[model samples]
Target: MSKPKVIVIGAGIMGLATAWQLAKKGANVTVLEQSAVPNPVGSSVDDHRLIRYPYGDKPGFVAMVRQAFGAWDEMWADLGERHYHESGTLVFGGPNTPRAKVQADVLATQGIDVEWLSPAQLVRDYPLLMLDDLDGGFRLPTGGTLRCGRIVAALYRHLTFQGMDIRPFTQVKDVDPVTASVTLADGSKLTADKIVIAAGAWLTKLLPDMASRVTPSRQIVIYVRPPAGTADAWRKMPCLLDIDGGNNGFYLVPPTPGTGLKIGDHIFSRQGDPSAERIVAKAEAQAILDKCAGRFRNHGDYRIIEGKACFYTVEPDEKLLIEARDKALILSPCSGHGFKFGSIVGTRAADVVMGAADAEQVRRWATGEAP
Candidate 1:
């Protein structure tokens, strides 16, 4: 029997990973991208993205994370290198910390190692933080960061080397889900046996019906240099999730190899034009700096290095949306914490395409409901 032909729209992490998996499974795969494979405009680009096992209240998500890690391990084996940094993550509670505390407690019930630290211990052990006003936090040893840009690039190279067609700079004008065909910007149509739309924030434009369920959210991540004396401490600092600032509280990714210290909040604007030029206004950027000033110790010593704007199609509950419609599967594997699970989501998509799993099962698996 001949291998099936597959068409994947958008070359983000999800698309690339899916393509890589299908190719490995002996499917003829072709990936389309509006930008380069490592397009900075897409949600997957950055110096680093945080990946961990502690998902505050969602044990289902935590369960799925285990599978995600395994998927990444498989990718590492195939790529002949690893793009992950195993830095432990520390999460502090804010006014909303009670909810996070509940999440941490649930994680403990699942046999995940969690170490609660007192104020004194926090100060003594992690002096780079200003934990004075916070209630308390815990350490989850399984979490860390991924070199996302490198991973995407590696997948592209791997897929291309495997004889999968990767079409960069090729914009997809329209897609016929029922027919499993794509109409390109140049008015050309390409048909395939299976179609997967992993188009991140651009999902709405391609499928107007998904506009309400999956919204394009404009998010920001800023990289900074630690205060003068705390450089070493910052470098060694594990990823931090400050739950104290309520919605404004941000997650911090420490500087690891090939990356810098990054700060971003889980808050989603749920508004933005992905095609518009990314312009970070002075006041908008300053607000983030000011927010960080209130959260971090020695804020004055930190120097603003870069501010980047990225987009993601977010579901209301922030779950991964992997729905098979007609002949296509629409994938939104990111809300804020999606990068860590990219490898698994991609593999799952391949499974769905190859009839190894159904769409509903993939959704349940993504939410940690299925084994």
Candidate 2:
């Protein structure tokens, strides 16, 4: 029997990871990316992304995150490159806040080497944070940050080294489920035994009927320089999420090797077209800076060093939609928090395409199969 030919759409973390897995399994694979390889606008272009084991109330996601770390480490070792930072992570919030307690409880239940820090303890241990208003928080020693852009580039490079065909600047205009073929924007058609749609925010655009299933929302991320002398302090700081701060859902990542500290709010509730989304405007960027100024210590000058607008292809339940749509397996992992699980999602997406796993199994291992 001939080996199956798999074509994966989108070249972001999810698509590249899936293609890498499929190619390694002796399948003929081709990755179609609409823009240039590692496009700057996609969710994967960020310098750093948080990688934590305990995901609040999502046990399955917690498991998937754990597995993803292993995969990332293996890849880094193979490439002889540092791709992840073991800077730890702090999830702090109010006493009765559900997210904080859930994270604490989850860490305790999993025996994940998490420390429950009281308000005073947090202030003493991590003086950079605003602990006066916070009730308590949990610290996971194993959590860290992942070099997102580098990972995506490395995956693409590795797959290219393995002789997989990667077509950049090739937009997948349409897909014919019956024929298992994809038509590119230039009117060229390519056939594959299986297809995987890991298109991120563009997934719904490709399948309009499923638009309601996935909505693309614009989000802002900002990078700012810490107070001059405090650069070193911020460098040593762990990734932090203020899960209960003003219901704004703020998170901060340490300086990305060369870039300044990164901060963003996860409070977007509006949808927009991914292709036409606006980069962070001055007013919005200033607001984010102001928010960070109050929450973090020594966050000075507040210059909008850099700002970006990315799309989050959110599901109603905020869970991933990993299922088979005809001959193609749709692998949209835009649950607003998908970047953290990129490696694991990529591997599972490949498994789904190869018939090695089903959506239920993947969901069971990733998010507990939704009750």
Candidate 3:
């Protein structure tokens, strides 16, 4: 596999990151993107994506996150710019605390400290919160936001500088796994030593066999401007997550230096066409504001700056779905939590393609079962 020629589909974070890693490993990689490198409809093209230590019942991801951070650090070094902001995380253990407690225990094993916030403290400190909960929560210094859009752009530039071929607006119609070739919408074909289908939400279109295994999800996130009364709190607010058992609660990313205040729920719509126009309905915007307004002060007057819709590939069990398909590999580090692991997903997969890593090991690791 020395200097293998590879063809990568999709130019989102995962796709571009894979190309970057592949180029680093001396592979001649050609990346075909349906849209621009920083595709606006991409799940990774957001103002910010969150990374927190508390993974609820999925403790394996807690350790995997450590590797993700390391990978990000390496990318930052290569780009000479750090696109992450450590705002910490404020957790609210709603009526359900079992999953929250498991998260706490997992963090404890890693020597991460959690400062418990009593009910009285919640009332005194975060005046922005409604604090209807009967009990208390904690604040861990291990969560933050990654500048997603910036990272994508930087990776694209980095790959280009490395002499990698990245073609945007090149739609891939189908793939020939046996010969490791990709058929374009224009009837042009390109062959390579290996093929990568990291097409995020549109993965099923390229690999119909994965339709039952991965469902495209339509998720919305709204950027808002807080009233002057709570502007300070909103500006200083750490990335917050409320542990509400199975029913997904809201996760808020506070404003960073050049970012907006973002709020999105963890629930998956499980219904969307990635090729369809992204229209964020008024009801959709209201739904998010309504669910999160109760958690903040000066909510009624807060103005919705913008509402954007992104699509994600979700699996039934909520773990990453990275599998091998003859000469092609399908990478889905998503289920609403993919962007955070973009760098590592590319690194591990590229290593496998370069014959530097074990394929089954990467799959197992992505499933959160790697030791």
Candidate 4:
């Protein structure tokens, strides 16, 4: 029997990772990317993204994250570069908040090394956070940031070297699952034995019927240059998430070699179209700056050094939808927070496409499937 030919749409971390895994399994894989690989418009272009275990309240997401970290380690060893930072993560917030307590509770239940810190303790360890009237905080020693863009570029290069056909600037207009073929924007067609739709925000554009279930939202990231002379302090800080005081967002990185601190909010829930999404708005940028100024330690006169607006195809429940539809498999995790699981999700997506596993299996582990 001949190896199955797989066509994966999208070139972001998830799509590229899925293509790489399929190719490694001896499948004839072709990745179709609408824009250039590692396009800045996608959510994967940030300087750093959080890679942590223990997702608040979701044991399944926590397990997936643990597995993902392992995959990241292997990639780092293979690529001969340190793509992940082990600065750890701090989740601080009010005692009664659902996300805050869930994060602390899940870590404790899983035997994950996490220190629950009181306001005074938090101030002693990480003076950057304003802990006035705060309930509590937890620290994950293994949490940190990943160089997102570099990782995507590395995966693309590695897959290309493995003889996988990656077509850039190739927009997929339509897919005929029944016929096992895809129509390109240039009026060309490509046939495949299996197809996986890993398109980030544009997944609904191709499958309009799914628009209601998968709505893309506009998300923004801001680069804040630390106050002069205090750059070292900010650089040494670990990736942090301020879940206290009813705030739900997290900051995953500090200043790198030359890059300044990157910050953003995770409160984007409004529906948006990827094609029509705004790049950045003055009002939105100002709000983020104000929040950072109020919360960050030694708050500097921050300027919006650079702003990037991307799409997050969020599900109603914020859980991923990895299911089979007719002859096509849909592998998308729309939670505004799915980029961190790119490599591991990609491997599981390949398993689904090759019939080695099913969607239920992926969901089982992601939702809390035990070993």
Prediction RMSDs, each to the true structure: 1.8, 2.1, 1.7, 2.3
| Global lDDT scores for all candidate models | 0.83, 0.77, 0.85, 0.76
Query: Mind giving the per-residue lDDT tens digits that candidate 4 earns over 78-152?
Result: 666767767777776645757777777777777776777777887787665566656767776677777888888
Q: For residues 1-371, what per-residue lDDT tens digits would candidate 2 score against the true structure?
A: 89899888999988888787787677898899999889888878878888877676866667667777777766677566768878877777644768777766776665676677788887888776667877777776777777888888887787788778998999999987767899999998999898888888888778887786778888888887666667777788888776544655678888856656888876765567789946568887877777766676655654678877878787777777777777888877766777777776777777777788776777555554432
Instruction: Rank the candidate models, highest lDDT first.
Output: 3, 1, 2, 4
Q: How accurate is candidate 1 locally (lDDT)?
A: 0.83
List where candidate 1 sits over 4 angstroms from the true fold: 94-97, 245-247
TM-score of each: 0.96, 0.93, 0.96, 0.92
> Between the candidate structures 2 and 4, which one is better when assessed by lDDT?
2
Who wins the lDDT comparison? 3
- State how far residue 276 of model 1 sits from its true place (Å): 0.4
TM-score for model 4? Answer: 0.92
Query: Model 1: which residue pairs collide?
Result: 56-103, 94-243, 94-244
